[model samples]
Target: MELVSEHVANWTGVRLFQQALRAAGGHRFPALPAALPDANGGSLPADRAAVVLAELDAFAGTARITDEVELIDEATGRVLMQYVESYRGVFMFGPGFQAGVHPEGFFVLDRADPPVTLFRAARFGQRALPGDRVEFTVGGTRTVVAMRPVGEHGEPPPERLAVRTRSRSGGDFAYVVEPLRRLCAASVATGNPVMWC
Candidate 1:
């Protein structure tokens, strides 16, 4: 099944991925190193569910996990990731900010100044203002371009103007913003690098 644009075979892979993120909590960026367990054949650690549960409790904020059982299911990770994107108005590489060819890879949008700036703001604990701007090279000349108010009246926030909400069969998924915000906060608080699996 496809979760947030990536394909995963079963909920086992989702559980394993969540465990990896929890294990890498407080880890630094560009150095979030962890080995992924095989989705089909690999088994999770005996205490992994507890660890993830604790992590969720620690970072739950206002966005409580409506269904704890979903934590072990692939839909939870995918839904959470979608909420993060919808709330933050940014496109994550895979799940969160980290992106790679495989689920384990992490990346940053270095080429674009505005995205990098906004990413830094969300990664840290700053708000990206609507008046933000950065220098961009056009044709050969560098010009200052506006970064904020990206959408009409800035309704969709920053980089999320282009995000198309997915259609779930059971109406729309109930998504809250606090969970995603707190997830970013938890990452900064623990220095645990966030990634998408």
Candidate 2:
């Protein structure tokens, strides 16, 4: 059987393929890489769920993968590799794979860009902003693993706080501003890095 389109339109393979391809060399097809384990049992590394998709702009003989790329035919249960046209050049799905060919860590999602929901935020019915970096897990079909924001360290966003500046005598200091208060509103100090009150 042949699919005229060269694009493998699925998420299962794209997330896994890119990783293996990069590590194993560009031309060499990589065996599916195992998903790294996280707190939620085991899921794809939240940091590396790259949606490698491009517009099907003016091109030929290569179709862009909009979502996931699968190796097996769901109906026939046969491994498949379809060559189709895409924006990035020839995109081949597979030469047909075995049942167990699926690589671990391939998290399936309904949409390419999953909603950003930190464990803490999800509890409050809040999602991450469009540009906020988030990671997640996929528990089942079209299931989303509530995303976990990444690259975040040290106390959550700052609020009200009290501080004291170093003072010796009754000095007529022009102003005193606490740098630790990230939310503190202060004007720039005339000569010092200190924010003038």
Candidate 3:
């Protein structure tokens, strides 16, 4: 399915969050895996589903407390659970967990039969500011440039932008890179053009 959003999104995280959205609205996502490993080195098929569902309900209720979702560490056979304060509709899953959606900045993905992927380090000659963004397009044969903010420069950034900046400044650049990397990898794996704007 084509996932459309005006904000930055992780491919898998967005899909999972979409499922949670549906579940929070009183619908179950049967597409969820039939089973997920638990911290006890034992699989908890039923409990996993229950925990996810319950958490969705709680999220919908705007509850402050988050119950632990028993999931096993993929690399280490240990329990992993934690809560992250959400910002800009982005709910960051705790460490070692890969199931949360973050919406920040903006990028549009245009699908192409065979996408072109490019990776290059930013070349800064001392003029590059922290707020400067690198414009990139993933799938298209042509370049795309985004327009600057319409308002005056002194104005504060939008809340979403502020949150995103905080996230990046807090050494969470990996969170942003991980999603983009996943998108690029997906394009490479599927032989499809993944456009970014």
Candidate 4:
């Protein structure tokens, strides 16, 4: 999930790349990076070992090429349809849409027994950021929700919610406070506890 150097990897991602290359016509490209040899230099190095990272760095340029790419099943060599790439780095198949390419809408259902859901935001045109309370009604499939802003010093925030502290950093452990019975816990670092107490 994390991108680290193949040379420093506990297991080489080179194996995956090699498999992908084989599926993409290995010898056709001619710029494939050579795999690192083992101590015996007889075969491809172990998959569970770090690889020579420079070898991988060498392939970056060629991999970006928009050559006719098809994801094929290795065992059967069956080319999977709808997994084709038309232009460089753009997918014309699969879900037909890429994530994070467009902004995502988020929802938080507070004061309600259930939680908020957003199958599609355009259904309601709801706009909300994190730490925001939205009041909305759920449609049959796509939920329609709206944010209910809290009045500062005028009224309490929506139930089951508390005012965030100055620092939004996490603590060592995670716990929840009761909306009705919660206590104010503000710890100040001072030499004399009695002074602030």
* Better structure of 1 and 3 per TM-score: 1
Instruction: Give TM-scores for every candidate, taking all chains together and pairing residue i with residue i.
Output: 0.21, 0.15, 0.18, 0.19
Tens-digit lDDT track of model 3 for 1-197: 43321233544334434333343344342422232221123322333434434433334344221222222222333322221323222232222221221232222222234522222111101111244322333333323222222111464322111112111111222343344344444444555443444
lDDT of 4 by residue, 25-118 (tens): 5454333334322122232223211232222333332433222223222333332211111122222211222211011222232233452223
Residue 146 lDDT in model 3? Answer: 28
| Candidate 4 global CA lDDT score | 0.26
Ranking by TM-score: 1, 4, 3, 2
lDDT of 1: 0.29
**Candidate of highest TM-score:** 1
Candidate RMSDs in Å, in order, are 16.4, 27.2, 19.8, 23.4
Please provide, for model 1 over 79-197, each residue's C-alpha lDDT reduced to its tens digit, 9 standing for 90 to 100. 22222211132333322222211121112243343435312211111124446643323234433434432222423332211112332211111132233334434445454533334
When sorted by lDDT, best at the front, the candidate numbers are 3, 1, 4, 2
Query: Which stretches of model 4 miss by more than 4 angstroms?
Result: 1-50, 63-117, 121-125, 129-131, 135-142, 145-197
Worst 10 residues of 1 by lDDT: 67-76
lDDT scores of the candidates, listed in order: 0.29, 0.22, 0.30, 0.26
Q: Give the CA lDDT, 0 to 100, for residue 17 in model 4.
A: 40
* RMSD in Å for model 2: 27.2
